[model samples]
Target: MTAPVVSAADLPRALLVGVDFGGKAFFDPSLDELALLAESAGDLPVAKLTAKRRSVDAALFVGSGKADEIKALVQLHAAQCVIFDQPLGPAQQRNLEKHLGVEVLDRTMLILEIFAARARSHEGKLQVELAKLQYLSTRLVRRWSHLERQRGGVGLRGGPGETQIELDRRMIAERIKAVKERLVKVKRQRGTQRKARERSGVLRVSLVGYTNAGKSTLFNALVKAHVYAADQLFATLDTTTRQLYLEEARARVSLSDTVGFIRDLPHALVNAFQATLQEAMEADVLLHVVDAASPTWFEQVREVQRVLADIGAAEVPQILVFNKQDLMDESLQPRTDEDFFELEPGRSVPRLFVSAMTGYGLPRLRQAIADCREAEGDGLINGDAFTTQPYSESDDQPVIP
Candidate 1:
């Protein structure tokens, strides 16, 4: 069957804003990410508003003063939508819209909308819809506030105080329940596939990291599959796996690309995609790819680690891969500096510096994967899992340039 068509005239123009909220590390990636979301939703980003804050106002995420500023900017730029880098509560969203005189979208909803548009596979679509429903279920009052005028019953007497938002919330809650049931079946099907792979005795290596950190790019280069690799955040939503042949030693392993993680990942999404992340948790090895050239790479690493922890994959064996080596220092001068996490004097994981785009250090990276694979007993599971040997918690081994 043919799919429905959407015309260009239906697109909206939007303004992107990043909120720092004081003293915290400002992650500029969220603005770029917001732009991606806007583009995915067929909107144009005309301006941005960034500010510091101690805490968000319960009514307006940005203070009334800042909200007024944004309101004026929205009018000056004639923007149809305002996108925030932080999630806004239902009351906050309603308050912001009423003050701005324009629609306002928070980080979570904007991301969910993008996922809704990008989801292709049945499971992917179902997961996205389920997450959207859950999010909407929580904020149904904010969405259908306009319907409060039509609460009359079948009889001439109108119902006293039944608001449209409450009714919509009920509908969304029911829909969420149905979606969860569907996802349960999808998860079960995925489980069967995973078990089949495990029985094949092939080493499973999952690539995981912050969004746009080059996981998909490296996956494409290594497995030679043209899975969508872009500079935009969350460009790839669905998990893609390919068989990788490492060496003439007949090393066979399945490398799976997982949905990229981000800071403040909505709980709804996390819950909806639990089965997808299980693929990573069950992997024999994890390639924690980082955009080495990014100024915030360290924070990105921490955020990815946090997500892994949330998904219960923190203890899994991981090899740190610093990608984008073409952007690395040209001198190739080896630096002995250790990251803050590794500053404990004797805590470290294997690390590799490489460029997925330029193909620099890729051979070494692949070789390192093979070496890690060799460390595993019978070439299955993290070798550390099977061995009682005291693994030394040492600094990242010095890379041989």
Candidate 2:
């Protein structure tokens, strides 16, 4: 993984730990992405440790020996925290904190922290708060040290700590319900807006891709709107929409830029952001932006597809916009402006090469969008346009080709 863009002086020092269980297929072999995540969450990674285990140790996820090694490294580097690349059980997490003598966090918490920091809009903040509350609800036992102590009072049937935990849990539950209700109302408002757009017969196109894949840059280039575009992960958290008037099709198309996806995205996040992600699900066409210059571009593509499937946007017709072509070497550049990419065994989608930062191949992208608009019009005239599929919840599954 690329080194983090943060200076050690400016960010809290952290030690990264990754465990390799023999049977797990989703583990990152290099643990570089974890470093990126740590940096994205405002942590400066000072050292990295990896362990190979047959299975997780019951008491500590990495066993006592590895824990000691990590502790030594933490002391050596003056690290303030240790981050694990995998999720840990509540007990295991508490145990790690006690053994290491420092704050311990897992990937889920790191992502949640980043979301909490990056959320800008009211709806975005509410969603992040809800996800954080749900995550925190599961680990309340570790938050307080006196959870086992008891108290006796006139109306106190339970221990003081137990009562506190119960009260906090109940408050969180109520807040979650309130947030969900507000989100439902927001979803209804969105649906009404979508119906209005549909009645006007405007084509909806959404930009979807992995985080930091130039989706926001492309959106800015296409519509001339200054939605935040930065080199960091998740530069833009809120979904922004604008109208793009296509000269070729002689029509104004609704273009939306939504949140980017990452590998091993938490289920709580996926559920919390459903109101925002519904833009992609309801889109007439998806512009799946991609970073063509990255070495792991294919893996990134698969990860984005997995999230799309999770959010019920897999079946939408997608046109892959391979962004950042200007950064690619000459030999790796595509010969044509547009071609077909086989995303799965039987699924082939249109692919276009473009550099959103430099306007290279952008005319071709506009032409492609215009072509899709024309095709939709032709289908409507012929009474054979593919009907939009009704959105439904489904179990998250790996998308195997």
Candidate 3:
């Protein structure tokens, strides 16, 4: 295992817990993704435990026996915290912490923490703050219930004190409101830029896919820009746009590299980043990049589609770019570099193989984009549609062998 990104000296040792409800073949028994998430968030996962349960236990989540086991592990390893791969209700979270005698965090909070740390731009920061506030807002309940002895006003009902809870709620609400208002301005600014691009009549394209699927790498490869690209989750939290010139089309298109999606992305987080995600939703076309070398590419593809549908970008025309082609086994390579692959039943889209790293089959990817632009000009996507057609490379361009 790798050392924590933060100073390894005193990094929190975390115990990871994941539950399988059974009958779901997609369940990861090893909790590898959760481990990656914890590592990305600066936690050192000292131990991991997986369990099978038919239903959730409201108070303890994994039930008393499993929680005891978790507590034993925490004691054995001296883990500073317990991290759950599933969402924990407020009561469940509080109960887990009390039972395990350590801090308890769920998948949602782990992701939000990573977002908070990685966000750079003002808009990105504001979005993360809003998400954290919204997420924390839900968890304010019963947390201060222990303060019943300090209750204000009335018959000493001896209920959890409302004064502190109300004050905290008010504070979060005010901050959330302020952040939202600021984000509205950000959205307007983005809309203004979008309008300017619309006026220019250039074809718009946005790169979107699962996190760390090489969208940023491919974006740099195509546009020749220096946007940060890394081999980690949520590395790029903001939208970056650049002009890409296609020689064959004799035209340039507005290309944007947007943040990546992930499994079980919180609704509040998605809602908070609406301004950033809007770039993908309103684009003329989407470059749906995928990790071609991944054995679970189909599952990843389905997850991306699910997110697109959630954000109302499901109808956008997409070009599936199977990236990391250089890493695929020779036996797995398709005879043709470009063809139509069925993204779902009755829906086939243009799929191309290209190595964003080694530049393999890039000529075909560029030609495919040119085809989309020309097709749009021909009222094809807006009227009929663009399909996989033979790509002819421009005479002036050098092909990557």
Candidate 4:
């Protein structure tokens, strides 16, 4: 369907495409999230197109017919680019770009672009560049015809059959290796810091959640530190940590705000951001923040869980912090401030409702963290009991207003 024209002259108009593979379970029917992603990447979505198929087309992904329809939409909307909700193969991407006569990007590229733009810290920028380079490496074939020309002359840089593409690929390979080496050093440095934290016997708590789920806001509230928090997707890329002193538990917790996760996060990004994500994996406790007001929160939860599992943080002790409680409808709001949420089969984690903006339920959330710290200190922390029995929904506990 045609999208209303946006008046922003600075934003490049884009056409969003989503293909519903009937058998795929991860299909986004409304393409609403894709539109949000486009906006996050500074693209103005002028139209949306969808197609249904049992499998992806070999050449254009959407096949020639749908490709033609998309071309029409692009012309109709005067779109400068077409973005697909699903990842496109290198060949498919190139072919689609050629046929549509506009830039074609898939979800992965769009996410990488956002990351490249949002990264502020030195480490964050390096990680983004590494991921982008890796992604570009695979699509180098025939990306530019000039790169296919042979370079062979007395004064030329290469011998008889060496082409520009080969030189470009070699340069990228060298850069990738260099970036990886630097990241290794950074990883080692982070390891040293984590070791120091461990020596202090302080609990490390990481805030992880779906993007724009108020994770940074909650972190700011808990630690009273100024972190860049906003309502936009992937607002902050750098991991910010601070010391949170709990008066009740008489403990100082190392609280860290991590980059938020999203559905279908690129593998290259996950690999590149390993140093940053290690905080969550090595945390003593994870605050899996959730936007209580979001209609698709359950799906968002599953996506975060999938990412957690990917990063080897699935078994980490997590306390579900349902943020933005003030935005929830009165009738739909949680009856209790603290409860247990079944994150997976036979696995229940402590859940608390809090509005970071309003400061409601923050005290009780602190109490929950203190309780976990106390349990850890007493050596009474049994994973099975901690997750399944003690705070199970079946337990009788007073519900806080």
Stretches off by above 4 angstroms in model 2 are 1-7, 145-162, 377-401
As for candidate 1, its clashing pairs are 21-53, 22-53
> Which is the winner by TM-score between candidate 1 and candidate 2?
2
RMSD of every candidate to native, in Å, equals 5.3, 6.7, 6.0, 4.6
lDDT ranking of the models: 4, 3, 2, 1
Q: Which stretches of candidate 1 lie over 4 Å from their true place?
A: 1-11, 24-33, 149-166, 329-346, 377-401
Q: Per-residue lDDT of 242-358 in model 4, one digit per residue for the tens?
A: 999999888799999999999999999999999999999999888899988887888999999999999999988888888998998877776466656778777767778899999
Worst 10 residues of 1 by lDDT: 336-345
In terms of lDDT, the best-performing candidate is 4
Q: lDDT for each of the candidates?
A: 0.77, 0.85, 0.85, 0.87
Residues 297-356 of candidate 2 have per-residue lDDT tens digits of 889999999999988999888888889989988778765666556787656677778999
Candidate 1: Cα lDDT at 95? 90
* Model 3 poorest ten-residue lDDT run: 392-401
Best by TM-score: 4
